[model samples]
Target: MSKSKFTTIGRKILMALSGFFLMFFLLQHLTINMLSVVSPDMFNDVSQFMGTNPVVQFALQPVLIFAVFFHFIMGIVLELQNRRARSIKYAYSKPGTNSSWISRNMIITGLVVLAFLGLHFYDFWVHEMTVKYGGGDMSGLINPNDLDSGYRYHEELVAKFVDPVRVIIYVISFVLLSLHLMHGFQSSFQSMGVSKGKNFIKKFGNVFAIAVPALFVFIAIYHHLQH
Candidate 1:
């Protein structure tokens, strides 16, 4: 049966499952990215492995792509349904009194994140694929570490942040991402029928929401200043 035909709770469960998977990817990707700040050699070693590993390349990447697509489409569907169900706003509605801005504006923040994802793919993924498969020059770009790592991925990464405009946009994106997580992190756990109504669980989720995206913003700023 189509997931869209499922009950609201069921669709939320699907969204939660996809969200958790994406969070796993976020952790792995963030760990690798932060290495560029601490140890470029380590970053290069890990990057090469991830780039060359047949399992990661063939299996996990496709799964991640599907997860992203599924989660995004489901989110939009839910948003539309929510709007339809509440077509008439309360006459004296005080939105802030009921819900926080981040919670209320999830769809807006998600759209910003989606737009950033497109720019991000264009800046890195598309370029990487072009150089890898289309015989474009990857070696011409100057390496930040002054060492020939035989791959220009690290150099390309640093290059992207050197632009002030890109850095600002990246910072803004991460901020919105953090706001999205502020609501999503805990909500996912609640949907999965775990950690619901638990104070400690809620606290953990709140901390994760702020910390993860802050780390990403720091990475972008660090690279921009380093260059």
Candidate 2:
């Protein structure tokens, strides 16, 4: 292949690798967050452990943050390059109809997800990390860092979903996530040149695409119903 084609191929490989890494991170995050539904104390213990563990705080957390940042930057770079290659114009514009809407608008959904991430950090991370250090009330939870403050972070999360507007937003964002994953999971494999053309691989992807977001939806609904 020519140098340009080789470079394009390499960039795609990087994007796919970064994307899959982020997907794994998402699953880990969701698993931890889902603990809040089972037991507040368990979630608090785990969260506090994650927050206070020396190895995790100094090592894994930084790595996780780097993964998120790298994935985001690569995604933007790839999308921009793709748009430029297409001359920023769609011929028929039926890509959304032909494939999942999330695939067609991954960038848009990613931005929405990014916004929610900010809100999420504000709700939990900022308070947990800062309030204990006398940074003051970021989300007005009152002594958010003191595990003994009876803060009940899980309860706080459920309360947030009590607002109809926020619930709607959460559900909508999750729907976008579902769409995004439907395209993402298989596309990542394709990018890696792992096209086996096997029924099992396709079925696994389909099941994963459906199950993951369904779990998120269930979590959202469960929280919404709690209040």
Candidate 3:
């Protein structure tokens, strides 16, 4: 059964599931990235493992890619369906009277996040793939001839954030991501019918949404400052 064919409620539930998974992924990614700031060697070691390991590169990577696309596509379908359900237009627009801007423009924020992902993949994953396969080097070294040259992962990361314009784009994208997650996180719980402790859920969602993106922004700025 295709996700496109799932009942509206079923689709919402699955969408929420994927959202949760992505959230978990984001935390793990941030944790690994944080190591770059704490210890370059540790970060490089982890990156090498992730880049080389079959389970992560083959099994989890594909699933992660699928989930990203699935969540984005499902959001579009859900938004269109919601619009269709409100076929009769409300002539006068009192924007905030009904829904917050964050709620109303989830798709817009998501598009920005999606665009950032493209830039991110080109910066890291694509480069990693090229190095690991195209260049025939999985040593994570600058020069294969010298062992004391150290790993290339940390340097590559630093180089990417050296551009001021890129850092601005990254920060802006993360701000929008926070807005998207602010609504999506709580809504995911709502869609899944976990109505128990609704207030607590909303509070936790707010914190997660804000804190995660804030950390990402800090990382980007922190790296940029280092160079």
Clashes of each: 0, 0, 0
Count steric clashes of candidate 3: 0
lDDT of 1 by residue, 1-227 (tens): 66566889999999999988988888888999999999876776687677667798689988998998998999999999999998788888788997899888989998999999999989977776776557644333345245553556577689899999999999999989888888888888889998546687778777887888899999999999999
lDDT of 2: 0.72
Prediction 1 global C-alpha lDDT = 0.84
Which scores higher on TM-score, 1 or 2?
1
How does model 2 score by TM-score? 0.79
CA deviation > 4 Å runs, candidate 3: 1-5, 86-88
Question: In candidate 1, which residue pairs clash?
Answer: none
Ranking by lDDT: 3, 1, 2
- Displacement of the residue 112 alpha carbon in candidate 3, Å: 0.8
Instruction: Rate residue 43 of model 3 by lDDT.
Output: 96
Each candidate's TM vs. the true structure?
Answer: 0.89, 0.79, 0.94
lDDT of 3 by residue, 1-227 (tens): 65566788899999999999999999999999999999989999998899889999899999999999999998888889899898899888899998899988999999999999999999988988898899989788888779988889999999999999999999999999999999999999999999999899889989999999999999899999997
lDDT per residue, candidate 2, 1-227, as tens digits?
Answer: 36574477787787778778877877877787788788767776676666667797789878877877776777788788878886557565666556666567878877776677677677667766675446644333325566356545666667777877777777777776766677777778888999687566667777777777777777778888877
Task: For candidate 3, give the lDDT of residue 53.
Answer: 93
